[model samples]
Target: MKQLLLEIDETTEAKINAAAKTAGLSAQQWLQQIIDEKTVTTWPNAIKALAGTWQDAPFSEELRAAEGQDISREDF
Candidate 1:
C-alpha cells in the first residue's frame, strides 16, 4: 500500500471530521472511501445488471448486423 498526504483549509478539514464522525468511520477511512468512489471506473451494479437486456428486442438482429460492417469511404 502507498501513503498519501493531503492539505485542506481549516473549514474543509472540520467538515470532513464531522462527516467521518457522523458516518462512524475514522477520518482516514472516510477520506479513502470518498477517493475510491470518485476514482473507480467500474460500472455500477444497477447498470451491470442491465447487461444483455435488449437481446430479444425486435431490433436486436439489425443492431448486431451493424456491429462491424463499414460504409463506403469517399475522397474529398
Candidate 2:
C-alpha cells in the first residue's frame, strides 16, 4: 500500500474525524472509500450482478440492424 501526506487546517481535520466517526470507519478507511467511489470506471457490483438476469434482452446488432436499401440524399 502507498502512503500519502496531506496538510489540512485544524477545522478540516476535526470535520473529517467527526464524519469518519459517524460512519464507523477510521479516517483512512473513510477517505479510501471516497477515493474508490470517485475512481470507479466500470459497473459497480450491484449493477454487475444484474447481468444474465434479463430474458429476451436485445443485443446491439439486433437493435441497430437495418433491412432495406438506404434512402437517397438530396444535393447539398
RMSD of each: 8.6, 6.2
Worst 10 residues of 2 by lDDT: 61-70
Candidates' TM-scores?
0.58, 0.58
**lDDT score at residue 9, model 1, on the 0-100 scale:** 96
Q: Per-residue lDDT of 1-76 in model 1, one digit per residue for the tens?
A: 8988888999999999999999999999999999998998998899999988875756777768858867799999
Among all candidates shown, the one with the greatest lDDT = 2
The whole-model C-alpha lDDT of candidate 1 against the native structure comes to 0.90
At residue 66, what lDDT does model 2 achieve?
71
TM-score attained by model 1: 0.58
Candidate 2 local lDDT, 1-33, one digit each (tens): 989999999999999999999999999999998
Number of backbone-clashing residue pairs for each candidate, in the order shown: 0, 0
